[model samples]
Target: MGSTKHDGDVIILTGASSGIGEVTAWELAKRGYRLVLAARRADDLGQLAGAITQRGGLALPVPTDICVEAQLERLVQMTLDHFGRIDVLINNAGVAKAQDAATPTNPHIDMILGTNLIAPMRLTRAVLSHMIPRRSGHIVNVGSVASYISAPGQAVYNASKHGMRAWNDTLRREMKPLGIKVSLVSPGFIRTPMTETVRGMPMVGPETVARIIAKVITHPQREVITPMAYKFLIALTTAFPGPSDAVMSAWRVWKW
Candidate 1:
């Protein structure tokens, strides 16, 4: 028999307090998926979790700081304890900011890379056992278009995302035969608190990314570059490296 189907299937969403994570949780709740919501703010997570349950959905709020390994381990354990299985893990928490070009300061580089890259890697490792045993699961890593393009002031951010993209690609290959699905969603710029602190950039609303993410989980693929235009851009970039660099350079005139 197939697994129990409900509008309340358990899905653990990191960075659930705001932005893409927030909207994705709401979308999942609408589709009847119970949520294990995580973020640094307990109040925010609690509020979202409560709203979800009040609307006839289910949620377990686990306030988390993904940068810590122990915290991520506990997160996985708690989800397993409550739901018996983790249906999906969305590695959605990350930080990004362009370092000033002239100064080139990187005082917080480790924090950026740790939270954006390492923590998700650790979280994914924590959940793999049950997923591999059951021979089923989905891992969605949120990447950025910057992963494919190299920009001057955004080097660190790109490197972190690039690492994630590469990991997603390799993980898909390693887990395919075991019936696991791994995917990466690289968005250009989503209008969120994370992006709002900066100024003058192309932006898509969080709901837009959330809708695409909801679809991606059920039907898995390698990687997605949203809006269809990115597919063409990536293809074009491959054939002419110098021009691609120029395009990336132009985008940074404002970013820097």
Candidate 2:
């Protein structure tokens, strides 16, 4: 779990087409880690892979819809086929919709939970079959501050992230003795294409997250909240839920 040399380590990364995943892929590749990139956008995934290969890094793009169990299985199989082993799995694919809890369509709700929560759990299970026998691997889940702080308009997103946080924590404990490390990297609002329309919140670039992920791969931890300041916010909110809820409610109305 803690190694400085990643010369030929195989890392399977979901959501590798853009944002945090793409950035993290490049960061890991720079550290000499062979990468198996998974994402629904084939063109983008291929392009990213090509770019990495051009830069003299080992990368394989496996276009995948992580929501589908068959696709997730295929992804794991392909990684094993090409790399012959899986060293790490970064579950980064996620989707979100800012809508009232009752107003959002069923498909939207399914998409949010399926991509953010269910898929990661399923994919991790598939990868574990291989990792457990080897007694070595790492699973880093990309979560959000929404997991700890709830906002009115983002009910579904909040739920999905909260579920992810729970899963990550429980899995970390379970994997500790198995020699498989599990970590959760929760970031505040980030400046990604996904958050282009988001406003009035401090945001960090995807590179900041990418670097943290690379570091976590080398030195695993239970959970990390980036920008450091959010740690204080989470502590404050946890201590005073009523005031926090009132502030979030006001912010939701302001956005409206």
Give all candidate RMSDs, comma-separated: 3.1, 2.4
Give the per-residue lDDT digits (tens) of candidate 1, residues 169-238. 8888999999889989888767888776657756778898898888787777788887567677678888
Residues 59-140, candidate 2: write the lDDT tens digits.
9999999999999999999998998999999999998778887798888899999999999999999999999999999999
- Per-residue lDDT, model 2, residue 209, is 97
> Candidates' TM-scores?
0.90, 0.96
Runs of candidate 1 exceeding 4 Å displacement: 1-6, 100-107, 197-200, 250-256
lDDT of 1 at 123: 93
Candidate 2: residue pairs that collide: none
Per-residue lDDT value at 232 in model 2: 96
Worst-scoring 10-residue span by lDDT in model 2: 247-256
User: Which residue window of length 10 is worst by lDDT in model 1?
Assistant: 1-10
Badly placed stretches (over 4 Å) of model 2 are 1-4, 253-256
Per-prediction count of colliding residue pairs? 3, 0
